[model samples]
Target: MRELKPWLDLIFKRPGRLVVGGFLILATLLSGIALLAVSGWFITETALVGLLLAAGVAATINLYVPGGAIRFFAVSRTVFRYLERVYNHDTVLRLLTDIRVALFRRLSQASRIRRGELSGAQWLSRLTSDVDALDTLYLRLIAPAALAGLVTLAVVVLAAVLFDVGTALLVGLLLVIALLIATVGVYLRTWRLSARQSDRQEDLRTAVIEHIEGFPELTAAGRTGKHAAWLMRQAHQVTSEQAKADTRVGWHLAGSHLLVNLSAVVALWAGFALFQAGTVSGPVLVLLPIALLGLAEVYAMLPDAFGKLGATLASASRLNRDCREDKQPGTPKAAGLPPETALLAENISVKHSGYAPLFTRFNLEIESGERVGILGHSGSGKSSLADVLAGLLRHAHGSLARTDCVYLTQKTVLFEDTLRANLLLGSPEASDTELWGILEQMELAERFATEPDQLDTWLGSAGSRLSGGEARRVALARVLLNPAPLVILDEPFTGLDAETRGRVSKRMETLLEGKTVISLAHGSEALPGTDRVIYLSG
Candidate 1:
C-alpha cells in the first residue's frame, strides 16, 4: 500500500478534475437508483387511482410531476454516465503518460550497479507489461471502489429519510457485511492464485520472445520442436491457473448476489408490515424494495476488483523497487572532464561483480585533438577499457576524468525506421545536406543513390537489409555526426573485407583528423594516421 502512494498522488495531482469526475460518477449512480424507485412508485400509485375510480370512489392524483421526475432521472443518468467515463479515462491516460516518462528517466539514471542486476527481458517487462498493469489500478480498483462506497451511503440515507432510522441502520449494516464478504473474502482466497497467474504470464512472454529471437539457432540444432513444446506447456499452465481463478470469482459473486437479494427481501417484508400497520403509504412501500434492488449495481463490480488486487500490488512493488534511486552513501559524484583534457586516468581499477579485476592501477592520458590507437589481443580487456573510458562502466578506485565521448562498438545497431531518423539519433537537428555529406565521406552515397527514398529509406531491424560492410559504414556515418570532442571505436572493422577495411580506415583518418580518437583493435595498422599506439596484456 505504501508503494502505491506516488501513483495515487499523481492521479489526484489536479484535485479539481478528480473532484468533478467523482461527483459525476456519484450523480450517475444516484440518478439510476432514483429512476428505478420513482418509476416503481409512480406506476403503483397510478394503478391504485384507476382502481378507486372503477369502485365509484372519487380520488385525485397528479401523474405529471412523477412522470417528469422519472424522465429527468433517466436523462441525467445517461448524460452523467457518459461524462464520467470520458473524464476519468482522460485523467487515467494522462497519468499513464506521466508514469512512463518518470520510469524512463529513472531507468536512464540507474547506476551501473543497478543495471548489472537487470536483464534485457526484465527491463522490457518493466517498461511495457508492468507499466500496463499499473495503468488499470486507477480505473479498475480505485474508481469502482470509491463510486460503490458513495452509492452505498446515498442508498442508506434515502432509506432512513423516507422510512425510519432503524431501516437506514439495517441497510447500512447489511451493505457493509456484503462488501466485506465480496471484496476482502474474495481477495484472501484468490491472492496466491492471482500472483501465480501473473508470474506465469510473464514467464510465457519471455519464453515466446526467446523462441522467436533464437529461431535460427533452434532450427540449426534440430531442436525447434522441443522449444515449441516447452512453450506450449507453459501456455497450458497459464490457462489452467486462469480457469481456476475465474471459477473462484464466479462462485463468490453468486454468493454476493444471493446476499443482496436477501437484503431486498428483508426490506420488502419490513415495508409490507409498516404499510399494514398504517405507518407508511402504499407508494412509498413500493419504492423501498425498488431502491434496495438498485444496490445490485454497486456490489457487482467488487469481485473482479478485489480479485486482481494481488497482481496490481505486486506490480506496484516491483516498479517502486526498480525505479528508486540507490546511490551509495559517502560516494563522490563523477564530474565531467575539463574542456582542455581529452581524458585522464591515474591508478584506476575496474572489476565486474563476482569477478577478478579486469585492470588494476591502469594509467592513461590523452590531450585534446590526439589520435591514439589501442592494440590488444583477444581477452586483453580492450573492450572493457573502452567502456571504462566512455563512462559506461564505473571504476571502484580511480581518479578518472574525460570530456563527453561517443562510442561505436563492434555491433551495428539500427532500428526499423527511416535512414533520416537513424542519423538524427546522433544529431537530432542535422540537416539533409549534412547527412548526405557524412554519407558521402563513408562511401555510402553510391548505395543510396539507387534507392528511391535515399535518406528517407527505411532500414530493417538492426540494419538487416544492408550488407555487412554497408551497415558498418552507415554506423560510422552516424558516429561522425556526433559533436562529442572524443570518439571511441571498439573493433569497428571486425567483419569488413580487407579492401573495405582499408577504405574505411582512410576515410576515418580524414573525417577524424581534428578530433581526439581512441581506436581499440587487434593492431594499430587497423586505424590509419595513429599518432600513438598502446598495448594491453591479459
Candidate 2:
C-alpha cells in the first residue's frame, strides 16, 4: 500500500481534470439509479390509480412530471455516459504520457552502475504492464470506489427520509458489509496470487526469449524438446495463478451482489410495514426498494478492481526498486590538483556493487594534451577504469576530477534514426561538410555516398543496417566530432580488420592531435599513439 503513494501523487497532480472526470462518472451513476427508481415509482402509481378508477373511485394522478423525469434521466444517462467515456479516455491518454515520461526520467537519472542489473525483458514489462496498472489506478479503483460509497450512502439517506431511521440504518449496515466484501475481502483472498502473477509472466517471457536465442545450441545438444517442456510448465504455472485470482474475484463479486440483493429485500419487507402503518405510500415504498437494488451497479465493479489492487501495488514496488539511484559517498579525498591536469585519480577504488574490488588505491594523472594507453586482458576491468574517467560510473573509496570529455564505449549504440541524427548527438551543431569530413577520415564516406540518402539514410535499429566495422567507425566518428578537451576510447577500433584499424587509428591520431586522450584495450596494437602506457595486472 505504501508503494502506491508516489503513483497516487502523480495521478492527483491534475486535480481539476480528475474532479471533472469524477463528476461525470458520478452523474452517470446517479442518473442510472434515478432512471430505474423513478420508473418503478411511476409504474406503481399508475397501477394504483387505474385500479381506483376501475372500482368507480376516482383518484387523480400527475403523468407529465414522472414521465418527464424518466425521460430526462434516461437522456441524461446516455449523454453523461458518452461524455464520461470521451473525457476519461482522453484523461487516460494524457496520464499515460505523464507516467511514461516520469518513469523514463527516473530511469535516466538512476545510477549507471545498477542499470546493468535488469534485463531487457524486465524493463519492457515495467514500461508496459506495470505502467499500465498504475495509470488506471484513479479511473478503475479510486474514482469507482469513491462513487460507489457516495451512491450507497445516498440510497441510505433516501431510505431514512422516505421510510424510517431504523430502516435506513439497517440498509446502510447491509450495504456497508457488501462494500467491504467487494473490496477488502476480494483483496485479501486474491492478493498473493495477483501480486506475483506479473513476475511469473516476466519470467516466462525472459525464458522464452533465452530459449529461442539459444535454440541452435540446444538443437545440437539434443535437448531442445526437454527445454521447451520446461517452458510449457512455467507458462502453465502463470496461467494457473491468473485463473485462481479470477476465481476469487468472481466469488467475492457473487457474495457482494448477494448482500446487496438481501438489503433490497429487507428494504421491501420493512417498507410493507411502513405502508400498512401509513408511514410510506405504495409508490414511495416501491421507490426505496428499487433504489436499493440500483446500488448493485455501484458495487459490481469493486470486487474486480480491488482484486487487482495487489498486482498494482506489486508493480509500484518493482518500479521503485528498479529505479533507485546508487549514491555511494566517497571515502577518499582528492581536493586539489595542478591546473594543467586534464584528469586526476588519487587512491580510487573501483568495482561493481556486490563484486570484489577491481582496483584498490589505484592512482593516475594525465596532463593536458597528453595521450595515454591502458592495456589489460579480458575481465581485467579496463572498461570499468575507462568508465570512471568518462564519468559514466562512480568509483567507491575515491575522489576524482576530469575536464569535460566525450567517451566512445566498447559497445556501439545507435538509435533507429538517420545517420545524420546519430552523428549530430556528438556535435549537435556540426554541419554537413564537417560530418562528411569525419566520415571520410574514418573511410566511410565512399560507402555511404553510394547510398540513396547518404548521411540521411536510416541506420535502422542500433545501426543494424551497417556492418560491424562500419557501425564501430560511425560511433567513433561521433566521439571524434565532439570538441571536448578530453576523450576516452574503450576498444575504439573494435570489429575493424588490421588494415582498417591501422588506417583509422592514424586518422584518429591526426584528428585528435590536441586533446587529452585515454585509450583502453586488451593489447597495445589496438591502441592509438600514446606518450605513456600502463599495463594492468589482474
lDDT by residue (391-458, candidate 2, tens digit) is 66788777787778898999899999999999999999999999999999999999999999998999
For every candidate in turn, the CA RMSD to the true structure comes to 2.9, 2.8
Scanning candidate 1 in windows of ten residues, the lowest lDDT window is 325-334
Q: Estimate TM-scores for all models.
A: 0.91, 0.91
Residue pairs in candidate 1 whose N, alpha carbon or C atoms collide under 3 angstroms: none
Model 1 agreement with the true structure over 244-311: per-residue lDDT tens digits: 99888888888877767777777777888888999888999889778878878877888887887877
Estimate the TM-score for candidate 2.
0.91
Error of 1 at 205 (Å): 2.0
